[model samples]
Target: MLKFFPEEIEFKVPQVMKTTKWIKSISESNGYKLGELNYILCSDDYLLEVNKQYLDHDYYTDIITFDNSEEEDKLEGDVFVSVDRVRDNAESLNVPFETEFRRVLIHGLLHLMGYEDSTDELKLQMRAKEDECLMLF
Candidate 1:
């Protein structure tokens, strides 16, 4: 089961369709019998605050995933995505909003799946995994 929380925040993201597609693909690719997953799309300021508070990072980022699952096969997490950053990155990368947004969503899920991007080599591997996952969409 997949759900959106709070029920108040209006998700006007144009890439929502693609994001859903990508999420499903990730779940399948990881061989996880997916359970409930939640997504919260917010502004850059909101995500930056989350990053600083939980991650101790003062910089803004595209997305953050909080895994709540008790087992690897049950994919459950709260994914906080910055729609504002997605838009900015889309413009900077010369890609469509849906493409960049999907990329960010996959990036977050990969983190939940124990993939790290803190180092240059790891970032490359993560990007490769992202591309592989993106191909499933």
Candidate 2:
């Protein structure tokens, strides 16, 4: 299951059903079944607080995912996204807002899929996989 929530923000997620289907395909294609996933869209300040309160990091990030997987065969997590950061990143990256937003959304899913970006090599792999997943949508 996937749920979307807005926290101190008014952003609306486009094509909910289509996006859910795409997320499921991403999970299944990666050899894991989809589980509960929550997307909390919020302002950058809210996300920064979450970063500090939950992750002990005092920085602004596009998305922060909390893994809640209980089974080896399933993917479950809460993905908190900063709409403010997304918009800024879109403008900085010179891409459409939806495009960058979707990428960040899937980037959280990728984290739930046991993908990491702690190193340069892992970041490269993650980006490549993100591109491939985006092509599917």
Candidate 3:
């Protein structure tokens, strides 16, 4: 199951059915099954608090994913997205808000799939995969 909630914000994912279907397709195509995935949209401040409390990192980030899957081939996680950061990133990157927002959405999913961005090579690979998945959107 896939769900989206706005935390301390008044936002809705643009296309609920289409977006959910696309996300599931991405997971299945990547050899993983979609489990209980939740997306929480909130302000940067709200996410910053979560970062501090959960991650012990006192900084702002676009997305923070908590993978809670018990099976190897299934994905279950809570993906936290900062709407404020997404809007700012869209403006700074000269892309539409929707585009950047979708990127962030898939970025979290990719992370749940075991993709990492701790190094330049890994970051490049992650970006390429994100672009490929974005094209499917």
Candidate 4:
């Protein structure tokens, strides 16, 4: 199941039904099944606290994913998105909020699919994958 909630923020994902279906399709295309995936939208401060508490990091990020999947083919986790960061990133990147939002949304799922971006080459690959996935959306 996929769910979205607001934490310390009053916001709703636009075109929610379409978004959910798109996310599900992305997971299915990768040969994985969705299992209790939750997205929590929050402000930068809220996400910062979560980062400090859970990740031991003191920086703001667009999204944070905690993989909780026990089964091999099931994707389960909590994805916390910082709306403040997304909005700023959208403006900085000169893209629509919804577009950047979708990019970040799928970025978390890509991580669950075993894609990493710690290296320059991996980051390029991840960006290419994200672009391809955005086209699907």
* Tens-digit lDDT track of model 1 for 24-137: 777877887567788788888888889999999999988889998888677888889888888899999999888887788788778878899989999999999989887887
Candidate 2 lands at a TM-score of 0.97
> In candidate 1, how many Å is residue 24 off?
2.2
Instruction: Give the least accurate 10-residue stretch of model 2, judged by summed lDDT.
Output: 9-18
Put down candidate 2 lDDT per residue, 7-123, tens digits, no spaces. Answer: 898878887788889988988988998889899999999999999999999999999999999999898889999999999999999999988888999999999888899999999
Give TM per candidate.
0.86, 0.97, 0.98, 0.98
56-109 per-residue lDDT for model 4 (tens digits)? 999999999999999989999999999999999999999999999999999999
TM-score of 3: 0.98
Stretch of 10 with least lDDT, candidate 1 = 4-13
| Backbone clashes under 3 angstroms, per model | 0, 0, 0, 0
Distance (Å) between predicted and true CA of 73, model 1? Answer: 1.7
- The alpha-carbon deviation from the true structure for residue 91 of candidate 2, after best TM-score superposition, in angstroms, is 0.6
Model 1 segments beyond 4 Å from truth?
Answer: 5-9, 13-21
Per-residue lDDT over 52-96 for candidate 3, one digit per residue giving the tens place of the 0 to 100 score: 999999999999999999999999999999999999999999999
The local distance difference test score of each candidate is 0.81, 0.92, 0.96, 0.95
Model 2 root-mean-square deviation: 0.8
